[model samples]
Target: MSSAAATLKQQKEDFVSNLSGGPVGEIHAVAFVAPVAVLLWSVLQSRQSFFQRYGLLAFTVDYFLNVVAILLAKTLYSDFPLLLSLLLAVPATLVYVLPPNAVSPKRKPKVPPSADSKNKLDPLPLKPFLTSYRSFMLISTIIAILAVDFRLFPRRFAKVETWGTSLMDLGVGSFVFSAGVVAARPVLKERAEGRSMPWIRRILGSLRHSIPLLVLGIIRLLSVKGLDYAEHVSEYGVHWNFFFTLGLLPPFVAASQAALAFVPSHAALALLISGSYQMLLETTDLKAYILTAPRVDLISMNREGIYSFIGYLAIFLAGQDLGMFVIPRKLNPRSNSSAGVQRNTLIMTLAVWTGVWCGLYALSTNYKYGFALVVSRRLANLPYMLWVAAFNSALVLALCVIDSIFFPAFYNAADPKSEKEAYLTATSRILRAYNRNGLALFLLANLLTGFVNMTMNTLEANPLVTVVILVAYTLAVTSAAVLLDSYNISIRV
Candidate 1:
């Protein structure tokens, strides 16, 4: 190697060594506290006009905090206790510094509805999209994190057997589950409005809608195979990629929905079946067969591409059920009258779900027969599904809480219209940008990852340099998503 190349390589090695231990753990700790910080900022800054005039500025501040946190992890505080304390202190201090709204409530002005209002369906609400946006952003962040935290940085901090790895695996399931939920919502709503379809017809209809995704997956798979990209066989399989999972899983999910339509507690039933399957795998030699099968046919039968899809399907169904439960059944104009009631109901439901999550987590942890929670992305086991569901529910709940507390103030200041009208427009454009073109963003990220890997020596890059690269990659993808959304172009299946 040349003199400059050798120096760069040494720097990379030294940075990787540091990142492998305390720095990486601190980064994870910071990540765990980020949502809280953002929430606190939103609540405390409710009266500020800065967010109203420059919504992108708000997002920028949030992103900047995250970057700073990463830097802090690398430099100032490598210990979890100190880092976490600082994270907690910032939000706690803000709460005391920022006073609650002291302005008197404004009187509502009622407007007589036009004749056309009676015939029109109310606009689709933005609240549901809040969860959708958060999920999409999370998936994007995870993809970025994987590029740096797993691929570029040292492997010691991102070990495959660790809880962090397990959480990332759960995130994969959560991302797909959220997609399934959003896709199923319109169908469920139509059914609720007495436009029900036959189960087989519904299944087939879903498959039809998924045709585009299937085609894209095929194209991607062929491209990867032809290009001979670095394949993570252990992650999925020789022929299976994330895109393939996204494409193929929908049909099975639809089939599950159709088959289980008669069951009142279908989500619970799916969860039960997943647990039983995991138990069977644990007790028998089936896991070995699935993991070590020599032939492609046999391997596909057990790989994350196929059999593990069963658990993912279950997770999807559960997400659909949760979506149905959370979203309002009717979007009639009068539904706005009960917005507070609806918010309270969602909060209550979230609490109940949290209880369920805690119970399951405790049971899984306490079980003595080796039936403990085993989070295996390759297997998509029961515990993993539960964790994903639970975490997602909590996240949605947090967003809703933030919305209930601060969004109204922001909305009122930003718009002159009624609260109901303003609520619909409260969603940030940045979020809408990602939510509208999430698939495109994911595809773009993958393309960028490949491009960057080819152009730069990612595995031998300095940790700080890798972070900068990841941020740049994120910005490029996000900008594309935002720009596409601005043009009203959504790359949907």
Candidate 2:
């Protein structure tokens, strides 16, 4: 490389490394969830005829405001995330729940049919929240992957150097966890219905399914070195990358699917495996080897990725267990469940969230220890696992509330054989698009990240310029999936 180019690459590398990250508090993470909640509320509760006539324009505005605007605002206006949440939430709550003051008394407005009236309609055996969760993770990740290089993105929100919580750190873990949730969906349902696939079949199928990821991992490794990309060596060690971690994980998770007969429960198995791994980190030399060892050989070079895999595996397992609650059970079309069952599910979710937080508190606080174990995304340690679970489950529970309120029939039963769903608004349409074509969308974003980096000096861009580029890049990424979904395209691999 030329001296100037090499120096520029080094400067870019220094920008992202050694970030301390923001404080670990619920208040800040609220920035991430609030806009989404409001967006879904706004779009889903809109009258259907209004959407059919102006759907495209409405979706464009809502998507820009909620998804794109929130993405930029969270970083640019980092000081008052809670305020931002309320700004959107207060208006959304009022608009969705309250009667408009302008209407005359003679004309009665329409409200959704009461749940009592829909007693016979079965809830569609679909989990829109699960899709939304995955899309959120993916969207945050795609935004961060490029946004991190720019000055507009806050350093405090970037991944930490060694051990601490950060939005980017959670983003990675959430991606893995979300992947686990979706991957195990079909198998979990089949097993619940007593048609669990044979162990050998699952292992083989998963491995086959994972080939594209592994290949993409290889391509990423080659491209970084070949292009002399600005890489933070400590993030995943000298040679390892996240794609490799993601690619290698499925077989292990698939094996767990078969081992369910022997293991007591998915949650127990997740905790057991992760706890055992944590013990090894505490007792043996593995932790040191991962943290401080010289990068002389391949294993030492990629120690971070190799050692972190076990923790991620545990996380994926936990997601599978969580999926049992979040993903709807496939009921016979004739089966009619009461609205009470929906309330029961919500109650159970709150209970689960409570337990998750309590476990997280116990681990993080250790009951007045003054200093608890810091979360280590690099090591993917126990505290990190709990933190991921706590963050994700909390969001899931919140989304469930929104889904119940506006999309009440979401948890309603319907014929599994019927048309999947009929979402009216653009935001839901686009989110489902992203979910259907997740991996492809991610790969496209990575490619776009590379292209944008190579073409422009991201480290030097002004705030307005940064936003412009990010918006264009985001539009390109989102539009591709939306366009594909418009044509009935779904790319699995």
Candidate 3:
């Protein structure tokens, strides 16, 4: 490479490195744990016509809640997480406290004609909380991936070098966990219904499903090297990335499918695997080798990624366990499908997730003393897995509480067609859209991130410039996704 090009590349890498990791990711997590619930409760507490669903303001609010909230939290309010959450949530609270018709519905009411089948919106249960939460994780991850490269994002929210919880550190695990949850639709449902399947067939099926991911991983590895991108080797190591890690997990999950029946619980399997992995890390020279070994060979070159596979697998399995718990008892015998989360299941889900979150929190903090093993994204260690489980459960727990407060039924037979009533159910519209083809959206975001990086020098940009670029980037992304959703076009592989 030319001297000037090399110099620019080095400067770019350094500029971004100095901008990452601290308590901000954790603080943001704490701040957001309850606001989504608070917002829903506020909106549902009464017949408030002022804040009509799908109204421009409502869309703005919902859009921010799902797409923009974390972006801004990690950027403008990184230091004032609690305040920002309140700032976003207080309006929702106010909407509830306000009297009905407080803000008059602006649109004229249209009388409903005789029953029209085509215009009907089916009860949108489609695993409401699960899909919505997954979308939230995906959205946050996509936004942060690009934002972290800019000076606008808080350094504190970047991936930590070692053991600690940061927004970026949470991204990989959370993505894997969410993928695992959805990926388990058939596996869990079959288990629930007491069906038998050949273990080899199941493993082969998983391999087939994994082809696209494996291909994508290869593409990413080649593209990064081909372009001579600035890579932080300590994160995933040479030749390994998040894609490969995610891609390899399914086969393992499938291979263990038959063994799942023998195990008392999926959680037990997860614990067994992760616990054993941790033991390997501690009892042998494995941990030191992974962290400190020379990168003379391929295995050593990608020690972080290769070794961390066990940890990611555990996270994925835990997600599947959660999925098994949340899915409706009535499985679709013809296909692996997740519909509306059964209302009857919410109570137990709420309790279990709440308890898990609290238990994990207590254990991780050692009763406020400090983490026994600080969360290490690099190692994907026990603490890291536990943290992912805890945070995701907490997020889901919040959504469950929202569901309990808002929906009288988990899946409504039909939704109100009126524009005003649509607002009430419109909350999940964008989220559902993103969830439909989440991998596509992530891929698009990566491409866009690459384009932006190549086109401009993000590190030297002022905060305002950075914010504007981010907003534009997000708007472009959401708009495309929404457009595709509106057209019923899902780019699913």
Candidate 4:
């Protein structure tokens, strides 16, 4: 095989290894932690300037992607090698095999720095970790959904199923991620004009825009059959609890911003509060009170009784925090050779993470074998959290490494002009030319999942048929998401 093909194979192997935790979760933790250690070393050395420039972002992305990949794994079949290979391959091919010139870095033209230094400033130092929190929960909830589905129909759907939760997760994740991009655009533009919104005001301003989108989504959801009124409500559609959970996010995020005025370590506080709150809920009498009975509104109907409000609220604050870091500013572009070394180093780093992940999965198999885990429910509590954290950390690590290595090339090819301009131009085109409307796309996916649930509700099919149907439904939803994204982009322009 060619070097690219070999590299691709190696990456896939690593991804699977990390994913499976074959006999125990140790390999999983090792898969991620080891590379992190190495990257830390590289960063400390400062031998590779590219590594230094991107180390923070790389680490952040790594954790984010780890959640994504693991979540995908839960939803995919036990015999996932084929599909998994393809999923990684498609993106990997575009990133790794594509000709250099086709996606080469654009010539760095000397553009004047924006007048407002604040607007032109790089991401806030504290933001990336906060973003990592958002990513983890978003990923975790999706993974949790898959685990729940697998338990419901283990043999029939080898992988976890995504049904009711898809409404919230897809809707919320897309919106937040998109909103971050959206909020950043104007902030950068204002910088170019030499005016910077005070951080506090900026947070409030973002809330103003984001909260409305959340509210609008709720309104749109309510106008439909809704959870309580609909037949087969359990099978698909947005559950009542999601609306409640999501409804609370914006205000809660706004509150966090307010807290920042008094709290010096706002990010740390957010993390502590979120994690501790979750832990307390698990330990306290609240668990019995909340879980014993289900909440019955359109928003709360589909979920387990406990509010998890704090959990989701924490996620929102985390998102805000992350937004701080990811809002990129102008940095001196690296020389060509430096860029290449960065690219190669990224590839190597990904390889390391992948290997570690596989090793962890292999080790995890010895401990216990279950379809998926919910952090709160299991007897092996700390282990479960550790398991998830390890898996997620590695996944995010790999994603960051890949994005870091490939983003410049990818970014350049996407737009030939300024990074900010390119993002705006590209996103604007996406918003205009495609249905980048996440809510609409997710709604359709939920609709299809509902239809699948409706049809299969009574069927006593063989395992093969069940698997086929589940896979079909999954593919359908994924396709719809992509199409909707396209449509959202198309129309926005």
lDDT scores in order: 0.56, 0.71, 0.71, 0.38
Query: Judged by lDDT against the true structure, how good is candidate 4?
Result: 0.38
**Candidate 2 displacement at residue 55 in angstroms:** 3.7
lDDT of 1 by residue, 177-266 (tens): 677567556855685577866768867777765777778777877876665544445556666667667776666666666555567755
Query: Which candidate ranks first by TM-score, i.e. highest?
Result: 2
TM-score ranking, high to low: 2, 3, 1, 4
Two-way lDDT contest, 3 vs 4, winner? 3
Error of 3 at 397 (Å): 0.4
**Which 10-residue window in model 2 sums to the lowest lDDT?**
417-426
Error of 2 at 486 (Å): 0.7
**lDDT (tens digit, per residue) of candidate 4 on 1-493:** 4675445444422322211112223223322332233233223222222222234454344322343344444434333534543554455344434343322244322223432234332321112222333333333333333233322232222211221112222223333333333333453456447884565775666465456556655664575444322222222223443444454455455446545657664335445565566566556875454444355564345444124455444434433333333343212223344534644554464366445434543453334663232433112122232233234434544545533532353233322234443233111111121124444444454565445433443234555565556545544544444355434342221
Predicted candidate 2 versus true structure: per-residue lDDT over 343-377, tens digit per residue: 56555765676486557646664647623666888
Q: Residue 31's C-alpha lDDT in candidate 4? A: 28
Our model 4 lands, by Cα RMSD against the true structure, at 13.7
lDDT of 3 by residue, 170-288 (tens): 77788888877786678655655788778888788788768898899999999999998877787888899888888888889988666667888677788889889988887999999
Where does candidate 1 have its weakest 10-residue lDDT segment?
Answer: 15-24
Clashing pairs in 3: 19-155, 20-155, 53-423, 127-339
TM-score of 3: 0.85
How far out, in Å, is residue 450 in model 4?
1.6
